[model samples]
Target: MHTQVAIIGAGPAGLLLSQLLQGAGIDCVVLERHDRAYVESRIRAGILEQITVDLLARVGVDARMRREGLPHDGFNLAVDGSTFRIDMTGLTAGSKVMVYGQTEVTHDLIEACLERNTPLVFEAQDVALHDIESDRPFVTFTKDGQARRLDCDFIAGCDGFHGVSRRSIPEERLAAFERVYPFGWLGILADVPPCGEELTYSNHERGFALASMRSPTRSRYYVQCGLDERLEDWPDERIWDELATRLGPEAASHMTRGPSIEKSIAPLRSFVCETMRHGRLFLAGDAAHIVPPTGAKGLNLAASDVAILSDALIRWYGEGEACGLDGYARRALARVWKAERFSWWFTGLTHRFPDMDSFARKMQLAELDYIRGSRAAQTTLAENYVGLPLA
Candidate 1:
């Protein structure tokens, strides 16, 4: 088979890219190692930056999101048993975020692709990229116990960090930067209303905690845990108790406790590849970068990457303009690094380091106090939180 673009993975990045490209009359094939059920059921961050929401609307997959997703003008930060709102909308001149699950976005994109008969192949295994450095690039994979080959003008590696795309580039061609944190987030999902109208990120002496929700009735809460902590060690009640303690008295006052519908511990990490493009093969989403979830930039960053990539690909095919494609890595990396900085900074400010002494704790509190008092600091946070304008 031959296509203008052979995309690996059916995650949000891959699916969105395919949808946008097809909307522009570009033909692409999406390959996923997992099945559709697995893709839609995987739990992920729920916050949608304005750009992500806009991109979904651009592809005509946002009707459900517009109707069901919660739009928030701001969020909260807690310290020393007190909380303050950031007022992202006010600070950023009416910019806001959408509280919509990534799973729902994926499902919507998948439905759009299927409705339009986009070539999205699930259960594709052993996907490999060939001759990526040359103009004539192709992909090989096994599907349904049969080997297949796909020739394409370009290859998009949206298969995530563990996928075969980035690794296909020679090691000498890529430089990797990463920091794995000492802690993980122990999170619980329950059918309970959130403690507050907006997400609350709390910094407690014990550890960090966050209050979030998938809907008005489904709350997701998290507390910092050691890397060695086990699920068996934290029951629903215990998790609720820790959340109450870390989130302080105010959030706990209206907090609802219930049986957890889902729970897991996810390690935090920040990773970025210096370049996003390798000849005819380009990497997007987790394949190119990963940020800590403190700022909720993972899925949004993926959206930004593909949004830029689709524009470049569209220009290349429509106008035969190679500038966008040639400058893809430089442009994408600029925004990627800025987001990395914000997520890293937010994580450091809220999370308790294992080796943090009294002085470090005091410093964190002082900075939080400064942010509370300074409009400049709040404006900076708001601008970033609302998602930077696309360049």
Candidate 2:
């Protein structure tokens, strides 16, 4: 098989890229290791920054999101038994976030791609990328236990953290920066209703807990835990109890138990690759960078990458300009580092650091108080939360 571009994942990044390219009359093929059902059902992020929502809308994939996704003007920060709300709408002049899971976004994008008759291969394995420096790079994979190859002009590596694209770059040419947090989030989705309207992020001696929702009928919550802890160790009762303690006394009564649809633990970390492109191969989304879920920046950042990449490719192909594509790494990293900093800040403020002395704890509390009291500080948080405009 031969195409203009070969996308190496069916997650949001790859799926959205294919749709965007198709809209611009570009041809591409997508390969996925997972089956279609698994790719569409996996539970992930649920917050969409304003820019993300706008981009999806522009791509004609926001119909279901517009109908079902909840819009929130702001979120709450709980500390010292008091809840402080940062009005995002007031801060950013009507900018707001929408609640829609990454899974749903993937489903929408995939459906759109299929309706447009775009090439998407599922259950593809043994995938390998080669000749990235050449004008014609290619991907080799196996389907139905048979070997096959896809020749392409460019390769978009959106296969995520465990994907092979990152490693395909020679070790000597790569420099990686990573920080693994001592804590992780034990997230759970229950059938019961949510306890609050907007998400509440609480910091306490017990740890950090976030009260979020998947829909009107479903509630999603997270509690801090050890990196190595297993889900089997956390029974339903234990999960609810921990949520209550961390969310504060007022939130205790509002919590209810129900059948859990999903439960898992995810370690917190900040990761970035020094460069995102190597000749014909360009990395996007989790394949390039990862941020802690504190600021809900993971999915938004991925969408931003594809938006920039798709536009750059359009410029290179449509107008015979290589300038945009040549500067892709520099342009993408500007927003990437800002999000990295915001995620780190939000994680540090909410999590209990192992090295946090009494003085450091006091300072953290002071900063939290100032954010709650000062409109300027709240505005800063709102802008970051709503996300910077897509470049």
> Scored by CA lDDT, what does every candidate get?
0.95, 0.91
TM-score of each: 0.99, 0.98
Which tens-of-lDDT digit does each residue in 198-240 have in candidate 2? 9999998878999999899899999989887999999988999
Against the true structure, candidate 1 has what lDDT? 0.95
Candidate 2 displacement at residue 190 in angstroms: 0.5
- The model with the greatest lDDT is 1
Off by over 4 Å in 2: none
RMSD to the true structure for each prediction, in A, is 0.7, 1.0
Supply the TM-score for candidate 1.
0.99
Model 1 residue runs over 4 Å out of place are none
